[model samples]
Target: MTFSIVGRCEETGQLGIAISSSSIAVGARCPWVRAGVGVVATQNVTLPALGPQILDLMERAKLGASAALDRALCASEWSEYRQVTVVDAQGRTAFLSGKQALGTYHAVAGKQCVAAGNMLAGTHVIEAMIPAFENAPGHLADRLLAAVHAAIGAGGEAGPVHSAALKIAGEQSWPLVDLRVDWSDDDPIAKLDGLWQAYRPQMQDYVARALNPTAAPRYGVPGDE
Candidate 1:
């Protein structure tokens, strides 16, 4: 029913995640990320609290991605029914998809990223995503988006995807960029990619202004200035 990618951006040092699902509002239900803390995507009987708890542990430097996930899983009564992927501030990645997860559910952890999904055509969906993310160029968000595309190409969620989203954060709890396709008739991945591209310039401009507001106005036209 869902597919997701969680990763730390190597270039910007920002952690980001993206997800799409056949279910409505998948963004709101599946993807979870904290700027400098970590990233999580809990699906297959989603436990939203697990997202923050794992992030809190990572923020306190109490555990890495693997250990944090292990702790969370061990403490949960429904652990076997959950699928989760985590990536810490340091870019360490880990993932677990319970044995009881829906058909075709699986997870993959890479050098600094993790991708997971459930209710798909086969495990190959997630397997293709791992390498796509690893070999993808550009910022963290772009790579995460690429992984989403790969999964969709690999047969996506045993059904049509209706929702998609991308999240990134750093230094603050608030998201630096959060874009969602709550519902779409067209290709969700391409729509998401277009959204990312459209948002990039604006996001860069906003960051620039926030970092150096005084200099930002200088880039405007002379008459406007």
Candidate 2:
């Protein structure tokens, strides 16, 4: 049903996730990340609860990503139907693909990243994502976008992807940058890329405001004037 990558940027310390799926609203269903906590992408049968549950456990103590994922998998009723990838605050990464997952579900875990997907054309789909992220130059968000693009080129989901998203968090739980293409007639991944490009300027502006509200007026708002 979906393919996703969850990771942290070694350069920026920004935690994020990028996902695409044949299902509608894949962004809402597949990807979740909490900056300074961890990232989770729950696919296949898709246990949405595992997203926050894993993060909560990691927050309670400084557990490694694998330990947290193991604990969560043990507690879930649908463990056999779920595929999850997690990267904790310390940059440790982990992934689990259930035996009962749909066709070709797989995962790759690296020191700084994890890529996972189900219903893919082949195992190389997830493998391509890792090097794409590593070779991509720029911020965490850009690298995530590259990973998604790589997966798409590697044959993507077994079916057409309808939705995609990218999420990044910081000191606050609220996403610093969250962009989604819920449904698209065009290439959803490309649509997501365009939206991300358009949104980056606005996102930067918003972060600038948050850092220095007094400078808001300079950007042409009424208060700054």
Candidate 3:
């Protein structure tokens, strides 16, 4: 009941994942990225724990994305019911679609991105997302927004999408961009796009505030101290 792309920006080495689901709060679950580590998306039956655990492996355990996934899946009893895709810091990628994952599911990997979906309109849903990410111009965040919108343009999920999320991690431990529409009456992709547009200008300000508040500019809507 979801579609997503996990990708890295070649110029910046930033990691990002964009996702939408019929389910609420996909942000709190499906996508995980760690700076200098890797990216993970856990969907289908949705083993939310796998997202973080895999990142731990990539970080602390020093495992590559494929090795981390292979090692983790080898020890799991529920592997047959979950779908997972991973992209490491090196841009190497891997995908798994469990046997019991519901409805038309597919995974497509590319130059620096991987697109995956289950309970989708068809395989082409994921197919359309890949080049959209690869070919999209500008920042990594914009590329991701383009990919999710392309997924929807290609017919999207089998049902109406109620929620969506876009997350990008830069050199910081925290996400540089994390936008979501936990529930939307209309299109969540456009909602997320609007959110990104609003947030993009302030992105560097937030980072600067964290790194060096003395030099960070205040937009002046609220108290500036």
Which candidate model has the greater lDDT, 1 or 2? 2
All candidates' TM-scores?
0.89, 0.93, 0.97
Error of 2 at 42 (Å): 0.9
Question: How do these models rank on TM-score, best leading?
Answer: 3, 2, 1
| Per-residue accuracy of model 2 over 1-225 as CA lDDT, tens digit each | 798888887766789998988888988877888878988898888889999889888988667888989998999897888899999888998888888999988899865899999999999999999999988998788898899899989888888988999999876657998889999867998988898888877886687677798664366767566
Off-target runs (Cα >4 Å) in candidate 1 are 210-225
TM-score, candidate number 2: 0.93
User: What digit string (tens of lDDT, one per residue) describes model 1 on residues 1-225?
Assistant: 888989887777888889988777777877778877788888888887889878877878569998998988888888989998999888888888888898788888887888888899889999999889989998888888889888878888888888888988866657888899888878776888898899887776666678788766454666746
Model 3 CA lDDT for position 24? 90
Q: Which candidate is the best by lDDT?
A: 3
Q: For every model in order, what is the number of clashing pairs?
A: 1, 1, 0
Model 3 agreement with the true structure over 1-225: per-residue lDDT tens digits: 999999999999999999999999898889999898988999998888898888888888898888999888887779989999999999989889999988999999998888999999999999999999999999999998899989999999999999999999999999999888999879888898999999998998899999997898877666874
Residue 126 miss distance in model 1 (angstroms)? 0.8
So what's the TM-score on candidate 3?
0.97
Query: What are the per-model C-alpha RMSD values against the true structure?
Result: 2.8, 1.8, 1.0
